[model samples]
Target: MEIATPMATDDRARFETLLSRHRGIVLKIAASYAWHAEDRADLTQDIATQLWRAFPGYDPSRPFPTWMYRIALNVAIGHVRRHAPHSRLTVPFDEALHDTADDLTNDRDGLDRMRLLQRFISDQQPLDRALLLLYLEERSSREMSEVLGIGESNVTTKINRLKQRLRDYAAAAGHD
Candidate 1:
């Protein structure tokens, strides 16, 4: 059997592949939570930076996407906690998202609601955010639990609580 040799160039290439494949997921997840364009941009950059730092530790034996999610989500939650604009107040907009090439002009207020929901979701822990993202992605509970290393019942309970929290938050925010 031949032994494997670790190379920085190969590592960089693998990390870039990870970045390109998951940038959308990271940006969107960050976008939803950061809401404000500037904050979202910062958060996305933070995620990318974290990924770069964590890339060296990545295990070739493990599935890359799940590992990527863990790091990305952790960076996102840390960003919200460390650099979040105003905890108890809503940000007018996240400056970063509009920089993306999506045609969001038609549904302005709807985007606002999405921003609100993102902030609300950002309030949860990183693991919880991952779970919520998995749910919103229409992932099966088993898959979510597996991804987050939680029991199935735990996933169910958390998801229910998340929905209720969103409902209550929407009510509080004057959204129907």
Candidate 2:
């Protein structure tokens, strides 16, 4: 093991601060990819470890979330690919059940739509899922391109296609 120097300590402090500030990105990505809470926690930890390993190459001038997202998405995609054979396309019930509704019948439509959307998302390929997540996050095309390492035009084209597919999915589910 290498000895910790003053510069290393400073870098550690900086990484901790940045990670804390953007911890939601990690959690969101993890939740999107992992079906269970334990898996999400493990994925989150894996992402944090990868981020720390890559921190030395991080450019302070660039936005941290973009860089963090690049690493996190890559990790999550890889995790999904590796576990594909064993992976179940299950959405966490908490995601759809978290919101309180006094009138259950009134909210049934909303909950149905949410479940349909979640199922559609979970059925998508890893890259498609990442694109959908970034799109839903309202990330700009340029930012999505940078994070996904695709061209801006490619990001736009993929977004259009995904939107159409989502529309079809919803229509087929009788949500419209």
Candidate 3:
């Protein structure tokens, strides 16, 4: 009684590939938002789900990782929107649907401040997260505007504001 199940296999392979490449960054981003240890896996799952959901929407002309990053950040924030920010989130995992939110969050050291940075990062809209990631990666504002569908001036203004936001977080956290 052999069955021909192609879709499941394809989805699993796609998930494994994307997870292998982006899990670290996704984990980092999730841990930043979640304030507990138990939540990391949950949040990671959220990111994975979001990626899978957004996979079909991916554009070939655009860079894969950048597009993936957009999906990742968007899913993370969407999780927060659905679940309370401080509590551990538990959403049904679907390699197909994507996005449930993070469960990990613990910043025990100065290095942990990166999580807080993610908090600030995820605070913005998906487009803003993409913009900031590009800015941090040193992508030019013109390029960011193109990717984000905004004017370059808007990119500059947003960067200035985001930087200030990060600085404010650092100041409050005593990291700066």
Candidate 4:
């Protein structure tokens, strides 16, 4: 067995502190991607494990959330790809809405709006889902591009397209 040095212990403590502070990021990503509570829990655990494994390689000069988002998005996308076939991207919108509605205590109108948004997101492709998540999080275009491995112009273009799509969906759904 290897002995833990003081420096190693310090690093571990620092990592834990950062992880705790940023745990919401992991949770939100998991919840957006995983339909079931059990799947969300598993995804959260997987994200934590990946974050810890990647901590040694993390660059201090960069913003921590950006780095964390990159890893979390990658893990979430991978989980989707591995567990879900491309042809069956998600469960039916009504079923998903009912499942999620039971857990939300918001007003009926708010819940209905949220359910509509969720259905729109679920209908998107994986990359679009990631883009939408970052957009909703209000990440900068530069940050989004960095995390998504795409050009800034492409990010802007996609964001514009997604906004239009969402607007159209809302209008069609009589939420306009």
Q: What local lDDT does model 1 show for residue 119?
A: 73
| lDDT tens digits by residue: candidate 1, 40-124 | 7777888888889888788878777667767776676666566545662223334544553165544778777777766776577
**lDDT at position 14, candidate 1:** 79
Runs in model 1 with CA error above 4 Å? 1-6, 84-129, 146-149, 164-176
- Cand. 4 TM to true fold: 0.85
Clashes of each: 10, 0, 12, 0
Which sections of candidate 3 miss by over 4 Å?
A: 1-15, 85-134, 139-151, 164-176
1-176 in candidate 2: lDDT tens per residue? Answer: 88999999999999999999999899888988888888888899999999999999999999999999999999998888787789763345455346533333357788777667777788788888888888888999999999999999999999899889989999987887
> What's the TM-score of each model vs. the native?
0.65, 0.89, 0.57, 0.85
Report the C-alpha lDDT of model 4 over 74-144, residue by residue, as the tens digit: 99889889888644434234554576776764588888788778788888877888898899889999999
lDDT tens digits, residue span 144-175, model 3: 77656679899899899888988988899777
Q: What is the lDDT of residue 38 in candidate 4?
A: 79
Mind sharing the TM-score for model 2?
A: 0.89
Instruction: Tell me model 4's lDDT, rounded to 2 decimals.
Output: 0.85
Off by over 4 Å in 4: 86-108
User: How much RMSD separates candidate 3 from the native structure?
Assistant: 8.4
Q: After superposition, how far is residue 22 of candidate 1 from its true place, in Å?
A: 1.9
Residue 42 displacement (Å), model 4? 0.9
